[model samples]
Structure formats: C-alpha cells, structure tokens
Target chain A: MEAQKVLTPSKREQQKEARRNAIINAGYQEFALQGFTATKLDDVAVRAGIGKGTIYLYFDSKETLFQEVIRKNLFPIRDEAQSYAAEFKGTATEHLTSHFRRMYQALHQDRMPELVQLVMGEGLRFPEIADFFFREIISSNQELIQGIIKKGVEDGEFRESFNAEFTQILIAPAMVSALWRLQLEKQSPLDIEAYADAHIEFILRGLKA
Target chain B: MEAQKVLTPSKREQQKEARRNAIINAGYQEFALQGFTATKLDDVAVRAGIGKGTIYLYFDSKETLFQEVIRKNLFPIRDEAQSYAAEFKGTATEHLTSHFRRMYQALHQDRMPELVQLVMGEGLRFPEIADFFFREIISSNQELIQGIIKKGVEDGEFRESFNAEFTQILIAPAMVSALWRLQLEKQSPLDIEAYADAHIEFILRGLKA
Candidate 1:
C-alpha cells in the first residue's frame, strides 16, 4: 500500500497515456481493415488487451475513439511537415516540392492512406467528425501551404499575383495522388514520385518570378 | 387493329427507355441524399413510381441501378466537355480554361457533386463499381485532357514535356474544387468560379512554351 501510494502523479499519467495509445493503435488497425461501419468496440478492446469496460473509461464511444486515432496519427505527420518546411534552407520551389513529397511519403509510410478513404467515405454520415477534421486537418494544412506561398512571393521566387488560394490549386495534385493511392490505385496505378515531380515542375514554372 | 399493332413495337421501346430513365433519376436523388449502404430498393421503386419488380426487370440489383445512374449522369457531361474542347476556336489556354469552367459548371448545375462523395466514400467497399468508374469516367477524362495538352504543345503554346499523364496532374485542382464544394463548403465556402479562374491562370502559366 505504501509503495503504490508513493508513485508520482507523473508516473500515473504516463501509464494512462500508454494505455490510451494502445487503444488508439488497435482502433486504427481495426478500422483500416474493416472500415468505420463494421468495426466493433469490443474487438478494439480485445486487440488492445483490455477489458471492454476499460474502453469506456478512455473513450465514450467507438466514434470518439476513432477520432482520437485520427488525431494521434495525422497530427504528428502534419506537424512534421510544417517543421520540415520551416527548417528547410532552399528556394520556395524546393521548399514546397519537398513539403508536398513529404506529405505523400508520410501518408503512405504511416499507412494512413486508409484514413483519407474513411473520411471521404463516411464523413457525410458523421457530420460532427467531418467538421472536426475539416477544421483541424484540411483548414490547418491549407493555411500552412498558403503561408509557404506568401513566403515564396516575399523571397522573389513566386510571382506577386499568385493568389494564396493557389495553394489549394498547387496541392491539388498531391490530394489526387493520396486519394488515388488509397482508393483507386489497384485499378489505375499512379507513379506517385514521378507525378509529384511533374506537379512541382508545373507549379514552379507557373509561379516563377 | 392494324394501327395498334404497328405502334406496339416502337411504343414499347419508348416505354422501356422512359422507365429506365425514371429509375436512374430516382436512384441518383435517393443515393445522393442517403448514400449507397443506407438506400433501399423499395424506396427507389416508390420514387420512380414503378413496381419494385419492375426495377429488377431493368436492373439486376440496386448496385447495378446505381452504376447506371453514374453512367447516365456523368458520361454526358464528360462527352460535352470533350466536345467543347474540340469545338473551341481559341488559344490553348483559352481552350483549356473553357473546358475547366464547363466541368465545374456542369458538376454544380447537375447536382452531381454528391457523386464525388459517393465514389470517394463507397468505392473501396464496392470494387466493381469503382473499377467501372476508373475505366470509363476517369480514364476517358484523363485522355481528353491529354489530347488538349498534346494540341497545346503542337500549337507551340505549351511545352512538349507535358506528357499525357500530366493530364491527371492538371485536373487535380478541379477535383479538389468539386470535393471541397461538396464536402467542406458549409464550413468554408469555396468561391468556385474564382477558384477555377485562378487554377486556369496558374496552369496556363505553368504550361507556357
């Protein structure tokens, strides 16, 4: 009793985080394989090696847990891409192309491509989660690219008239690449690296000062 | 009696076409609103004002009906865009821009934006429909753009390096616009016309000879 009571609050918090992460990992794997509609909360608990009741202690529902899985998996990748752009010492074209490449790479490497399908596939049915994702993921990422475009103009790499909304236009190729890879690639294979390079070339030439 | 007999064949053909069309339209409306998994054939039959058994006469299953709906609605628009590109008597930039504008316009006017959502959302689950779409709509559209790019290069308006596959990259912006308009517009309205113009400007500059 004395030894258990002596454990630090920070240690207790770490345990909670570990348990939470296990649940998230299991949720992502199950959801990716079976999709949003077919997945069950009980299976997630079994996969995580926890009691079904323990899942409720962490997540109110499967949707809530799925949201948490997206948050954990996608946020780090998004943040890393932002930091990579910030830290890069290159021309705006290089910076943007590298950022675009990294987004695709991370998406595939992390096996998060299914997440895109899930959002596009089921988001309409679940408006609140869709709204959360739009605000958090789509909006934030657009802003990041918009900022890069602004910087490119400031550095005299991109033309002054390049509308910031062109960021969306610029990244549109990457979007298609991700979606195609996840949902349509089996039928129509996209050579993603080549595609990305070509996209960068076109976009750079379009924006060149 | 002779007049009635003569009318029977053509009149029966017209009735068959009309019923097929009605089922397609009703399927589009219902599927667009409720999506594929949630939709029921009974509701579709009711909406089309046909016996539920009549639906089976025209379509083998709900999925087949949905596939026909996609084909009838999207194919005409795709063909019209192709025709528009062929008919345009202008510079390559003007031709491409006109085609781009027409795609967005038709997508919105026909209320087919939900189709993007449907394909993105359910395509993975239903591989047959996905494969059909990839082969027909996507591959054909990509080829149409490829032909335009080739013409642009031949006209000394665009560089020769713009490969046929570049067509996919070129059209990514329109894909994003359609998706954003359908899925995220309530939270963040996309001024689609302006977006299309900006896309045209950037793409034209990018492809300059």
Candidate 2:
C-alpha cells in the first residue's frame, strides 16, 4: 500500500513536470514568432494543448512565462560555457578558436540567433527583460571571455597591454554575425564559418605577445 | 508682375520644404520614443504641429514617413562618409582613426544610436523597413569600409591576404558599441573614446602587414 501511494505521487509529479515543459516549449515558439508584446497566453496554451488555466498554474503572468522560457533555453548554454571554460586546458588561441566554433554550432543548432534578435528588438521597450538578459546572459558571457583573456595575458600568450575589459571588441564579430543573419541573410548571405575563422585569426594576431 | 509670380512659387516651395522637414523630424521623435508599430500618424501630426490630414499630404502612410525619416537623417551621414573617404589624404591608419572619431561624434550628436535601436528592435516584424535599411544604410557602410581596406591592402599598409569582403568585422565594434549604449549603459557605462581607440588599435594591429 505504501509503495502504491509513493508510486502514485511520482506518476503525478512526472505528469506535472511534463506539462511544465510543454508550456515552456510552446512559450518559446510563441515568443519567437509573435515577440513579447504580441504573444497571447491563450495562444501558448492552445499550442501546448492545454487549457488556458493550466498555464496560470505553471506561470503567474506572461512576464514570468517569458522569463522561464529564457531561463530554460539560455541558462543551460551559459552554464555549459562556464564549465567548459573552467576545465579547458590548452593554449588560449586554441581554446578561443574551439570555443568560437562551438558557439557558431550552438547558434546554428539552438535558435540562439532568434533569441538574441528578440531581446535586442524588444529589450528597450521592456527594461525588465533587458535587465534580466544582461544579468543572466551578457554578464556571464563577458566574464567567461574576460577570464580567458586574463589567463592568456598571465601565461604570456597575449600582449601585456591587452585590456581584458575590452572583451566586447573580441566578441563583437560573432554578435554582428548573428545580427546579420537576422537582418540581412536573404539580401546578403554570410559565410559564417569563414567569418568565424577571420575573427579568430584577427584577434590572435592582434593580441599576440 | 513677372518677378512677383516667380517669387510666389519659390516662396511656396520653401514653405512646402519646411513643412516636410517638420513632419520628418516629428516622425523621428515618435519612432524613437514609441517604436515602429506603436507610433501613430496622428501623434506625429500633433508633434509636428500640423493637422492630421496634412501628414497624409506629405506621407501616404506611417511606413512612408518612417522611410523618409531614415533617408533624411541617415543618407547625409552616409554621403559625407563617402565624400570623406574619397577625399582623404593620408595613410590608411590615419584615415580610419579620424573616420571612427567622426562616426562616434555623429552617433552622439545625431541620435543615430536610437535609430539603430529602433531598426534592430522592430525591423524583423517589418520586412520592408529591414530591406530599406539594408539597402540605404548597411550596404553603403560596408562598401565604404571595403574600399578603405582594399586601398590599405594595395598600398601595403595592410596585409596582402586581408579579405576586404569581411569589412563587417572591421565595423562590428562600432555597431556593438552603439548597441551596448542602448542596452547596457545604465548597468555598465562605457567610455566611448576609450572604446573607439581600442577598436582602432586592435584592427590596425590585426590588419597590419
């Protein structure tokens, strides 16, 4: 009887977790398609194949749902990057090259470019979303790159005068590539791999000790 | 009587030009403040201190007004950049440095960053605006930078192997800086001068033979 009772709750818990994920996946699609302001919770519920109230059970408001969508989709990538940087053992140049390649892969696989577009497009109008994005994504990414640069400088692989704070400059090419894909991909298709290689080569040459 | 007739039409033409400028200026403010979708022509008319019908006399729709806004404000800057590059007399390094400095000045003075934010934020939802922006602003800018890189390479100031087609990387920092100001300036204030200097130094070193 006790085993039955425990198994029943576990089954219920599994159902609940599944429902939550369905809502988030639907939210991602809706937000990506309709943007922040235009996305209706009812539409998300329909997409998720759930009742409208079910979304309320999982997420209190549209803002919270959007936050969860970002958290679910982006936080994993950020965490992976952090751990990857922590355990990386190689010359900084190799690390950066490999890291950028992986980043482009992520951009291709994950719809990260769309998310970046959503944030840049809607962020100023929604300051809270902007703040959350900066805190959750931008700052973490900046820290990861800055750590790599500092380590490179310490190991005498990079110029002593290289300002680690200017990691933005180092990463600007990737951001620009993403923006290009979103804005001008049809009119001007970019060779992203070649672009990535150029960026990596330019930075390494510029920062050589 | 003949002189009066000529003067009358010229005076009317001057008035028409003045009114057109007022409408464009008002459209800029509305678009910047409220974004593209949310901006209404009625509000723009009020802002321009004209009747609602008068805006229609000048602009067929909000899209047309927005296009005019972008063209009037951005085309001048692009034209000046073209002329500056054509007339520039110095090494490529000197020219780029001065060009970047002037670009920054325009970004600060002309509210160009806000316009960039507007286009990036709302461009995807409106494909026509995106297409217009790509044609009017982005292509010209890329061509200008490509021309400079080509000149530098030919003159032996830059590496012979440098790819002028990758001019996007050369100009990415400035775009990133503009975006950073729009998004994260409150959280992290960037010194624009130092940022521009870093960008120029990094690119020069990266491209130098």
Candidate 3:
C-alpha cells in the first residue's frame, strides 16, 4: 500500500520528460547548424516553440541543455550495448563480433560522426562534462567488456595472455581510422561497422591461443 | 675550392639558426602557457625579446613556426630512439623493446604533458594541422616500428601469430593514458613520463611472445 504511491511515475515526471525531450531536439538542431559556441538558448527556444523562460525551467543554462542533448544522444549507444550484454550467450569471440558490430552501427548513424566531433571538441573546454560521459558511458561499459574477457580467460575459452587494459588502444584506432577517412581521405562513407568488425577479428586472431 | 663556399657556415646561416631557436623557444613558452588558440605571434615575439617583424624573417607565420616547434621538440626523441636502435644487436625482440622504450621516453619528456594538451585541444579547431602531425610524426613512426616487428616474425624471434597491425596499437596508449590523466582526472603537475614508461611496460608485457 505504501509502495503504490511511489511505484509509478507521477504526472509531473511525464510532463518533465516531455519538456526535456522537446528541449533536447531543439538543442541538437541548433548545435548541428551553428556549432556549439555559436548556438544560443534563444535560438533553441524559438525552434522548440517554447518561451525562453520555459527552457530555463527545464535546463539551468545552455551548457546544461547541451549536456542533456549529448546524454540523450548517447543513450541509444548505451542501450544497445547493454542489450548485447544481455542477449549474448555464445563464446566471447562470437559475443565480441556481435557486440562490436552493434557499436559500429551506433557509431555510424546519421549525424553520429558530427556528434563525435562535437563531443571531442567540447570535451576540451568542458572536461568535467566529458568526464561524466566517460565515467557513466565509456569506462563503465568498458568494464563489462573486460568482464567478458576475464570470463573467457578463466574458462580457458581464449588465451590467458591478453591485456584488457590496453585493448582500447587497438579498438580506438579503427574509430580514428573512420574519422580519418571522412576528414582526411574524404572517402564516401563506407560501412564503418564492417571495418570495425574486420579490425576486431584481426585482433582476435592475435589473441587466440 | 668552389665547394668550400657551400660547405662553410655562412654568417647568414648561423644567424638563421639563432633566430630559429629563438622562435622555437618562444613557441614552446607561448604554446605551453596559453595553448594554440589563445597564442599569438606578437606575444611570442615579446616573450622571445625580438621584434614582431624579426620573427617573420625566421618563421613564415605562426602556423609554420608552430610546426617547426613540434619538429624541434621531437628532435631529442628521434635521437634517443636512434641511439636505442643503435645499441641493440640482437633479434627482433630486442629492437622492438628498445625502440618502443625510447619513443615512450620522448613522449614523457618534461614539457610534453602540457604541450600534448595544447596539441590535442587546439588541434580540434584546425583539423588539417592535427592530421598532418598524426600522419607525418606519429603514423610514419608506427610504420618504422612495424618494419622491426616484421623482421622479427621472419627471423622466428616472435610467434608467427603476431599481428603487426594490432601491435602498433600498443605504442599509442602511453600518450592516451597521459591524455586520460590530464584531460579526465585533472591531475596536474605530475611527471607524465614516469606514467608513460609504466604504460609502455604494461603494453610490452602483453605483446611479448
């Protein structure tokens, strides 16, 4: 009986989420077009069809609104990775192939490339915000990956001699490769996941006993 | 007799080196303090005790001057790595180990921690510049490292299973760990080379056959 009142989201919660989503959509549109520094709250408010005061109620400032937009954009990535963790029941190798494939999909989504540049660019200025994303989104998720490798090692399903700590260096270059192709080589966008899966396979071959 | 004219260090050449050194020193001091964006030629000239126009004689512009600064800063690194490579007489393992250690040491130099931040931070606004450094300085160096590894695999010094591509990944995380320390953890004023050496050792241990 006492739990009933707290179990369900209040109407206020629904209303607040609605307002936040509206603000996030506005923020993304503005950030993508004007770049982050040049973007203004008034522009977001006008785009959202909300008053400037209404935006303030939802977000403390433009920075905070930008942070939420980033957070929301990252949610799909987090959700998919988490879902992969749950659904994966095969060898860690198989799981990794599937897992990395999903990650590349997230990485290559429309506007995701620009979003990466935006995140990295802003990360230089607002490191605290970036740290928040790193801790909540990247490092913690990386721990899940480490757990899979650790399990594989323990079960003797794979080699016992890989350094999980340093694997990010291997994985990251492929992402950097994609960025390079787009930024430097100016190649028509290939399937980044296909490239990532091949890269992961290349590492797996080296790690195999 | 005619060859002597070209062989001798003309007063102009000597003066050029002196001016060039002044510009590099100014670049380091200014880039270290204000980062690339906030840096200006007039300010660097003031710091170097040279007239602004005088600096232009030595360096074409701030961009070219900064590139020269990067090259000058890396000279010791290249020399150290060359010394290590010269000292090694054994098979592939010895060469790869010594070569990597020297590179890591260069990355961990006294002024490098702050300079790396400046490069990564301000490099954001100038994609072409960051790409140039990565290609010419970093990626080309990795190709050298790969050549050593390939020689090892052929000589039976390392496992046939070794992946030169993945092995290349190990070289970079020494710098990434530094980025994590500075950019994320906010641990300022710590010696980064020590941190970098340990990171290199960790990677070497994993990559060792």
Q: Which candidate has the highest DockQ of all?
A: 2
- Write candidate 3's Cα lDDT for A85-152 as tens digits: 98779887787667666666676666666566566444445766766777667676677778777777
Better of 2 and 3 by TM-score: 2
Which candidate ranks first by lDDT, i.e. highest?
2
Query: Per-residue error at A207 for model 1, in Å?
Result: 1.3
TM-score of chain A of 2: 0.92
Our model 3 lands, by Cα RMSD against the true structure, at 6.1
Q: Considering only the true interface residues, what is the Cα RMSD of candidate 3 after superposition? A: 4.8
Superposed model 2: Cα runs more than 4 Å off? A1-12, B1-13
Give the top-scoring candidate (TM-score): 2
Displacement of residue B40 (Cα, Å) in model 2 is 3.5
User: What fraction of the native interface does candidate 3 get right in terms of contacts?
Assistant: 0.11
TM-score-best of 1 and 2: 2
- Report clashes for each candidate as comma-separated counts: 1, 1, 0
Evaluate model 1: give its TM-score. 0.89
Candidate 2's C-alpha lDDT? 0.83
DockQ of 2: 0.69
| Per-residue lDDT over A1-209 for candidate 1, one digit per residue giving the tens place of the 0 to 100 score | 66766675467788899899999999998888677877888898899999989888999888899888888887887788777767888777777777777776876675677777777677546878779888878877888778778889999888888778646787777766777887688987888778877887887888889
Which stretches of model 1 miss by more than 4 angstroms?
A1-19, A41-46, A49-54, A86-90, B8-17, B50-54, B86-88
All candidates: DockQ: 0.65, 0.69, 0.17
Query: Which regions in candidate 3 have their CA more than 4 angstroms from the true location?
Result: A1-62, A117-122, A158-171, A186-198, A202-209, B1-20, B32-34, B40-61, B75-88, B117-121, B124-131, B158-172, B186-209
